[model samples]
Target: MGALKTSKRSDLKNCLTKCKLFRTDVTGSRLYNQRA
Candidate 1:
């Protein structure tokens, strides 16, 4: 049970990181387009 909990926590962290990266990518592209 403890191992399962740790694995789930890591997965959640990974998901959050991915989401943050995607958000940044989208915003960056928008800014770039506006400047062009």
Candidate 2:
């Protein structure tokens, strides 16, 4: 039970971070290309 709870929490955190990173990556590339 404890392991499952911890894993679930980490999974959610990873998901959030992944989403943020993906957004940043897309925007970053767009800005970089535009400014270049």
Candidate 3:
């Protein structure tokens, strides 16, 4: 049970990181477009 919980926590962390990266990518593109 402990191992399962740890794995789930790691999965959540990975998902959050992916979401943050995606958001940054979207914002970065918008800024680039405005500058261009």
Give all TM-scores, in the order shown.
Answer: 0.95, 0.78, 0.92
| Model 2 residue 3 CA deviation in Å | 1.9
Each candidate: RMSD: 0.4, 1.0, 0.5
Candidate 3: where are CA atoms >4 Å away?
Answer: none
User: What is the TM-score ranking, best to worst?
Assistant: 1, 3, 2
* Model 1, span 1-36: residue lDDT tens: 999999999999999999999999999999999999
lDDT of 2 by residue, 1-36 (tens): 999999999999999999999999999999999999
Q: Residue 19 of model 3: what lDDT? A: 100
Best by TM-score: 1
Clashing pairs in model 3, backbone N/Cα/C closer than 3 A: none
Better of 1 and 3 by TM-score: 1
> Each candidate: what lDDT?
1.00, 1.00, 1.00
